[model samples]
Target chain A: MVENTTHSEPSGDDIRPPKASIGVIGWLRANLFDGWLNSVLTLVTLFVLWKTIPPFFRWAFVDSLWFTDGAVCRDAPGACWSAVTTNLRFIIFGFFPYELQWRPLLAMLILFFLLFYSRDRTHWNKYLAYGWVIGLFLMGLFMKGGLFGLTPVDSTQWGGLPLTLLLSVFGLTAAYPLGVILALGRQSSMPAVKYLCIIYIELIRGVPLISLLFMGSIIFPLFLPEGITINSILRAQVAIILFTAAYIAEVVRGGLQGMSQGQYEAADSLGLNYVLTMRLVILPQALKIVIPPTVSILISAFKDTSLVVIIALFDLLKTSQTVLSNPEWMGFSREVYLFVAILYFLGCFSMSNYSRRLERELDRGY
Target chain B: MTIADAEKVPFYLNPKVRAVFFQIGVLCMVGLLAWYLVSNTLTNLERQNIASGFGFIQKEAAFEIGESLISYGSADTYGRALFVGVLNTLKVSLIGIIATVILGTIVGVARLSSNWLVSRLSKIYIEVMQDVPVLLQLFFWYAIFYESLPSPRQALNPVAGVFLCNRGVAVAIPEAHPAHAYILSTLVIAIVAVFFLRRWAKTRQEQTGKYFPVFRVGLGLILGLPTLAWVAFGSPTAMDVPVLQGFNFTGGMTLSPEFIALLLGLVLYTAAFVAEVVRAGIQSVSKGQQEAAMAIGLRPNLVLNLVILPQALRVIIPPLTSQMLNLTKNSSLAVAIGYPDFVSVANTTMNQTGQSIEGVALIMLVYLMFSLSTSAFMNWYNKRARLVER
Candidate 1:
């Protein structure tokens, strides 16, 4: 009887909907538990989450000490948030005059605002260049204030997020032009120029940044005339600039290699000289193609500024380490390091995301 | 095209003349700069009373290194101390590279998994790890390990014969025994045997149109032969399990906390980049490939092994090599945490002997050698990976 019923054609009104895997439950069944192995994996992942997350939440949030003194946190069973909050000012402006902390604060604001303004490629013109020049001058004036009646803060006293931004911004800005010139020189018809560029780039790229920083601190001073001392921070900044230029030269050369031969011929037919041809035609297109990789180099260079810690410069990372080294806040390195990591993540992530967006927007069909 | 037209050009305007003049200008400027710098450096060295030469490398290095691959002491020669540092750097880099490849490949493939949870978790891991500076991560990890772990007296014993404490982590290993040499010889033999067996299997399959399970057979030869040799030799090697002593664990192998932290920092940070490279390489292979292989009745594993990976390797190897080199260079960050790597050792030497130039030169020379050798190997691999056409 059941077989006969199945054999009969279904009436239109009695027709049933087909079962489909679409919603959350369906998705779980299809993705998480599609087979025995997947089911096992899903269970294992759940078990791991179960083991780690609850305790993490409890330690980080539920029982965490906030807005309290070190004395209160001494016996607390969870994280000491008060350590970071209490020493936040010291961490942000290491060794700078406590009263003049507002200067770095203002400088950071200017730097960030300028960075935000420069993100718009359509507005990239002479005005943008002028804006960077003015912004950097203002930042330097505010931080090193022997002018305008503000107390002068020595470069050695510069630290924390402001120092990080200063190093990365100035290092990248100064390095880009030098890198482009080196790349062009490497491609020159003259052997002397080409080999000079090659040796400079290769030799710099061969050594680690730490050694370069050491050279800047120790060996470089030896190279200078007697009693002609540079600011330690200035030395480190120059080291970063030279080190970054080498990597950027390699990347720019790659971009140059990507340019079609026809473009070169077109420039030649237009009667453009070498510099004119590269500036008016080659660089624009080549630079556009290399934006993603260039941004990557810039981001890594930004992070490499943290290596200034080894040279005893109190950059963001070094400042955090200084904060944790205090006996009162010694056990609170987790909170301090976490805060520093968040700051760096914000800088690096935004740059990378912007680069991806630029890559997508600039990709005009080959 | 005429002689008169060529002769009419001014010297300044001539491209050839300009090129030659520019080259001369560059050479002169470089020569002047070098002359000035070398003269100034010589003066400074004389003033500072710092002897500048490679001779200082042979002097006794009185500072202790926290970790070294080979036996090293404060009494070791500066050259030997530097070599120990190099070995330490290589140890971290080699192990880090291996761990990174495996972790990167897994996370990379998981990024493309149909499982929503798996892919999202992988994506989150890559993004978070990549965004943070590695030095900061190293400090964080070192601090966490120190804070979370109990003192040596109350060290956490998660497994038998393994201890974890603020000092470090100690894991058990098989103690060297009399038959160890025989066991190693057997391993070499197994490897050679597998190579020949694979060749024979390939030839036989080509002739008879039958497939042999070469992988399973090869695994058996490599693993089984060594085990068999060990058993026949009366199990000469035994586990050298670590045990908690008064102040520290004594026994098998102990990794210093600094080393652990640096290794974690380098491997985790670089794996994120490696994962991206892997994902890009796999994506560069067209989607039609898997379908084509499947239509030909190849199993899923065979489809991946024979069709997908070989093509993907061409895309992956270049970026992967660069990431490896990056990781190698990054091991220098060991200085930040005082891990006694090459840079750290060199820094000490410079400070002690006041030989900054030679010390820095030694660091640069070693790293340059590493970078050149790595790139040379990659170039060779790239050539082998190139497509062959009739």
Candidate 2:
């Protein structure tokens, strides 16, 4: 039908569109007020916005008690942001000795700086790898502190932003290589290897991260020799790695399947060995094609780090809960939770936007 | 030159030989690690004097579960308590999946609305929901439901015979009698008969090129059959209207605050992902296809139902299945709010019996089964959807 329309030669009347349907007003008419149903939808949406937005604005900002005491906040008819400011320290660095709190703060800054540095794909090199290693080592040193004449803090003391970053950053980095291996194993000609990979991926993907963390914190201890303790934080980290790797493996396998078989045949015809063929011909394209899904997996892995709270490790979310649990600041949970929500939103939203942009840029050649 | 060209490569350099050797090496290493762990666990259990295995599941569970679908007491065995927990988990997850899909599909269609405000609102919702961590959302809703509601004595009666309080939302439900069994069985039989009727109708339509009112007929079979059975059985179910008696409401179905909050959190969070899936699925049906359908004089609704939806569903079902699986697994987060879900109950059992291994294993097994069943159903749907081609 469209072919028939296109095949017919256009006359003068067909070439010139109607004048009332060409500008911004015309767009509004066509899209928003195109018909009776659309007009009603527009009015209903406007009514909903009018009913909700103004009150939210007034409560969140106009009447909000941002810099005040608990008593003052209680008297106020709006949000009590004082809950956030008053307990900011506890929320950001839960249970780290009060005087040495600067260490975690420093560690978090380093992580953010490293993350900012790595966002530029043009700077991808061995230097970036070295920088991450150095930065992560520094962060660990600052948190754990067995060297540089600093007093040692136990792993139990590690909490808040540093723990969240450590879990997500390390978890994703470790998971990616492991995921690639598993993806390869799943595609291998060796039946045992293929089945092993398939089973591992499926089993891990089957359960929730909470169950995995529970296994790490409670059940894994049973497997260890008596009195040989692994810290709860590390165990949870391992669980996150295992869980995330399974998902990432599937995403990577999708990329692998997308590659043309001709590329493999060409490499084989060139007398390239299996390792050389995969490393030179397959992996680079496969990994590039998978960047968007990989980033999504990373983003969700970052969010799943919050589940460590179930194991009683005080990551950012748990710390916020602790802040609310204080009787004096109990009624201001709305302010505290929203504040934490913003932090997560910033991380997730930015990664997703990056993925979209990267997808667009990669699509250019196609 | 011929001698050098004909020379054979060493066995160590052969790729196939190396691959087999690597596999054997890995297997042995894994086997050794497993052996070491098992041995360590056996000795550790011996030292702690905590005998291991599934024997403890039969022991009496002294801990109280806050909510249950079946009649449960502290006197029940650990196995029964866990079963109650499983039922609770399934209850919330089933409700969450259904609610999320409906909400997601609406928002997804709204995102494509010609009304600019509707699409923008939907976009904002998806962005906010996609970004926030779900556990935090759960906590946010839980906090609101737990603290912000009025006390039981002054509970908000938003509608007739319904009460909402910090405790929970209570509404009227039907009280079942002995004759309800007969009614239920009759309804089930009617539903099976309707399923066959629809199949026969479709086959007839295909063979004869005649339209049948299959949907309306099926609906009548479902509703009329159930109503007739109820009447025939002397109205076996009676309304159990809730009444404010003393400090709290009595009678009717009570949705616990924990269950409601968890339901809202899981549904809202998973809906965001499902919305994106739906949007993608709908958008995947090309504009050309819609235009072609319209050119054939098909109405807009018919174009959607007959042409667009079948194609959109092909794209939608795979991701939809994953989202469903995710919602089910995420019901475990009910533990954070003391929802007494499978994970929470198993955790309690583990703490009481010191059988952490078995408890964790059971949780994993249950989740695996849920995942497998969902995937199995999806696979069947995929096959059916594919059959629509040609």
Candidate 3:
């Protein structure tokens, strides 16, 4: 636009370009030092970066140990990731029979493939729908073992990333149907059932996740029959599933409430039964409306899985922290924590981007 | 009209029958699951013989809390110790919420600024923060910030006699005298007087189209009343500024780095969400309000203060309330950094006494109370904030 104006009036050679700035320097000025306040901020930020970067450089590369004889890390001035480099296998899969590690890794790859394939809208309604169900069974059999040449790995030994992924994936999938039922119950014809659903959802949503996990891991035992103990990781999985169901139920209910009375009336006029109405008519729209918020909840559930480290289940965070706890890896906490943090951030950010894309695309529908 | 009245009773398609069947199916499945877990726990407990009940509440905690609302020590009951822990959680979270809301609003507005640098800085801030897990952020601040401070003897920032150190910041507390107490009482009286005066001023303005200086009155009342209090309270105990006491600073109130780190992390994290809510609320208001206010002979600030905020607040409060609730829940992450909050104390009690159910129940109840009251207060505020739509 500025260029058009400048060319139309060739009164002067300079013509005072709207953005006279050029190249990297111009971009920096426009972004970082555009005004007095911005220039001040730029200086402050530059100072901070200058102070922080060199130490990281020295620690991560120059002075740090990348590989060692396991115990030779006492002399490093910066990061000591030698322990992580050495013990990454154990951290990724704790107490799992070492030979069985390949099976879990393979299962992870298949999960990535299925999820990647399903993300495409064309694939979503086609082959991926069937593949998702099939993939779950395959991921399970391969990871837990009972199929192929893999040795059976007990659920108790399921630690680290594999366990974290299973808990979150199943937590979201199981919660989807359970949450819809709860939402329907909350909107039920009977006051007793409606009120009960309301109270259950609100009460569970109000408290912290740690308390729920605590209830499942410890209190849940008391209400159960003798001699049928659930494993720790399984208990945590149940905890996340129940927790996510309560939250997603609320979001779905909000979506249902947002729908106009006309839609319901139309469905009623068509002589659809309640089940048929919800499944074929109301829920399809409501779920679409709630897709954005529910996706954020899914992301939160993924992040919250890290909290299981507290109960001593070795999820990604716990495994990293466990590695930190060892005297052998005492000096490498910063490097290990940062590495794990990057992995978490990347996973969450990509999902957030996808959800935003879904929101925009779905919102375009009538 | 409503699906034509069904004179003949429906068969299996009857809603009642379907509901009953579903309930029975769910109940049976739950009952089986319950049976399995109960049997397993009883076997596990019996083999272990862990006495389960709330009898542990009366026992001595035998663990000292670094901070307490009511004086507590190892000699105190486990109940008292748990109370102390809950108090700490409340103390940290309450202050954290206040700080976060203020900071979040500022940063949120900054992110929407016409100024290019401020907006970019805020965007970067929000991105860098949430990407890092909050627990790790808390550790980064705790380990990297205060842990890098100079020793007490080397006291970094000296204010009057106040000292900052790795040992913690020691601040000056006022030593009140009789005059200071009188001043304090006078200040409270001044505030009440200012309140009455402002109401009269507003009434007068409505009647006569003349405005009273409300801001000046407010400032005078708040500052003068406080000053009068200081004089009346007998000049108070001159702050017992913590002088460097060997390896640690001593004498004044000490804020543990754990508290600092936890509070900062929560504030920084919550601020990002708060900013988004604020931005949305502001954007939700029609631009015509600004134009209309300008047409009516109002300044930009007047438009914002008198016209815009009144509407924007209705949009803002619901999300803001949820953000506050989130901050309260996230405070439990204090355990990761060893800041002995409610769950931490309960955890210790549970581990030592093996009274898991009672301990967890107490913690849940406390959180429920906090959450309910917060939600209730927000609902009342929303009612007040709602548009009359007349």
Candidate 4:
């Protein structure tokens, strides 16, 4: 049974290390190049790189169909940059009114800048306050435009990236507080409210968000008074808001439930009310526990903005679809879809990576 | 002293009084909001002349699902259509869950392999799969796997002339004979017997460190007994291999592109999540546990079986349960791929009948039931597999 078996666990102060290398490099040599399976996989991956990477580089850069205007794409023999150029506005705007496109574009840029600037350590908390006040004021001034001698853009005209960003930011900002309250309410000792929150959370969490969105699309109108009608964008936002709140509640509730009851007792002993206890002690821990899931939910919501297309709201994917329907570039479906996929991938991938890092950071204690 | 203790809570500091005041305020705000919304809905519905209620569920559907498990067509009632949708959703979830678990476990174990390539490949799979939006993955797989398939005339017969094409795949299937029913019955009986026997063996093992060869026995009982009956039943089912027909193949079994795409996407997307769960589960078992088993003179395999795996399963099963729930929920993406899952069918029913309220309610109820059952099943499993904490 022991005939010439050479495998053994290397010792800790492995004197000469079984040759020139036995740790990382030896392990790699023994694993990757040792067998046909590994070799084949290696070859396959290399082959894939060779095949896809070159063309990717070429089309994206080297021989790219860039900057020759919309008409030059036909002769370019690579990815049609012309399609992106011509359709870029629609792709980002969805259906926002053409006249006030600058407002949304500005707002989106400001939000992006705010997110980046907020992450900078040099600027204290006051910067965010300034950004918020000025940013919102400017956005409102631009969007409403009645007092600025700017052409007023209707909400219906909001189409692409701006709409998607606004919806997501609004949904997230609204959902977080609502979600926390609901999570707290669900975990509360109250007989009526706890049951109510539980029912709401479970019912919402059980279904696909698309179903909720569909319900909202259909249900929002039903909830409106006879004479007054809400805009479709607002209707969509309501669906997203409720759905986001429910999901965020679950995430927050996870954090809440994970907290040892000792923390609550300790807070209670300190004579702190529920609000003060939560704000000071409970929320910080729960927020840490649920950070990764919260980010993922945000990412998911970002991705989910595409689903609004199903309800006839022209988010990015819808904008892409609109591009495809163009009579001039009718058959260029692949290019358009790829562009949309790339944009989505960028957002989703970054958040997923960030979540992984956050999870690691959070899990250090565990 | 009790009276003094009761009076410790000042009027301003009375907790019950505070709760009441806060709740009343909350209730007032909620009531006003609800009142506004309800009045608005009433006006809207009345103005639109839209009659609400679920009477529309009984109306004839006059529509068809591309893929139907149960007997269904355009002639079916709306209720029947909804049932078909529910069945489709169940089918996708069940199949997707099973496939994802197997694939995920395989990939997860591979990631721990001494083989660097295997681990790297698994990592790549997880990243690529998780990075792309599921809808995009669905479309990608649908386009690549199904839409790009050769025409029926050029069908690729990978196994026994099973032709795969844009329409679907056609394969050989057995035609059931009369005696086949007895064979199936015998199989069921054998499986039940095996289950009971396994439970008995487990108890016996626990009672006296003498382990029964339950795996071998159960396998033999389940497979052997049914196979014996199959011969005795005179081979009722006949093999029916798909034949090349005019533009398409005449089938034994068929899988539409929509079903294929939905299953592929669900499996691919979910397997990444499951791999992470499996990895975490394995990692959760501390090295000391394995080393302790080894120090006690057990072999590596025995160490894993006796100590590491048992403890790991405790950690694994909980999150694994949620992954299953996620897989089940993700099956709703079937609608996007045009595979008439429950949601899609419900949507169609809603649209045709204009009974949005009823349709939405039913969708929620069905999903609730699905999620509830899944959670219940997980709880039961968790209890059964619970660590024997002293």
Query: Which numbered prediction scores highest in lDDT against the true structure?
Result: 2
Model 4 C-alpha lDDT per residue in residues A200-274, reported as the tens digit of each score: 888888887777778778877787655567888888888888889998998998898899989999999999988
- lDDT winner between 3 and 4, please give it: 3
Q: Backbone clash tally for model 4? A: 20
Clashing pairs in 2: none
TM-score of each: 0.95, 0.93, 0.88, 0.87
Sorted on DockQ, best first, the list reads 2, 1, 4, 3
| lDDT agreement of model 3 with the native | 0.81
DockQ of 4: 0.43
Give the whole-model CA lDDT for all candidates, comma-separated: 0.89, 0.90, 0.81, 0.79
DockQ of every candidate structure:
0.67, 0.68, 0.41, 0.43
Give the runs in model 2 whose Cα sits over 4 Å from its true position. Answer: A1-24, B1-14, B175-186, B229-238, B296-302, B387-390
State in Å the error of residue A268, model 4: 4.6
Worst 10 residues of 1 chain A by lDDT: A15-24
Residue by residue across B38-120, what tens digits does model 4's lDDT show? Answer: 77776777788888778777778999888788798797788899999988988988888899999999888877776766788
Per-residue lDDT of A1-366 in model 1, one digit per residue for the tens? 999999988777775534456677677888899888778878888899899999989988999998998888989888888888898898888888889999989998998898898788888999888988998999999999999898987787888888888899899999999999999989887999999999899888877898899989888888898989898989999999999999999999999999999999999999998889999999999888899999999999999999999899999888888877888888888889888888888888999999998988888646
Error of 3 at B146 (Å): 7.9
Where does model 1 exceed 4 Å of error?
A: A1-20, A364-366, B1-3, B10-12, B203-210
Each candidate's iRMS in angstroms?
1.2, 1.2, 3.5, 2.6
- Score chain B of candidate 4 by TM-score: 0.92
Docking quality category of candidate 2 according to DockQ thresholds: medium
TM-score of chain A of each: 0.93, 0.91, 0.90, 0.83
Provide fnat values for all models in the order shown.
Answer: 0.78, 0.81, 0.50, 0.58
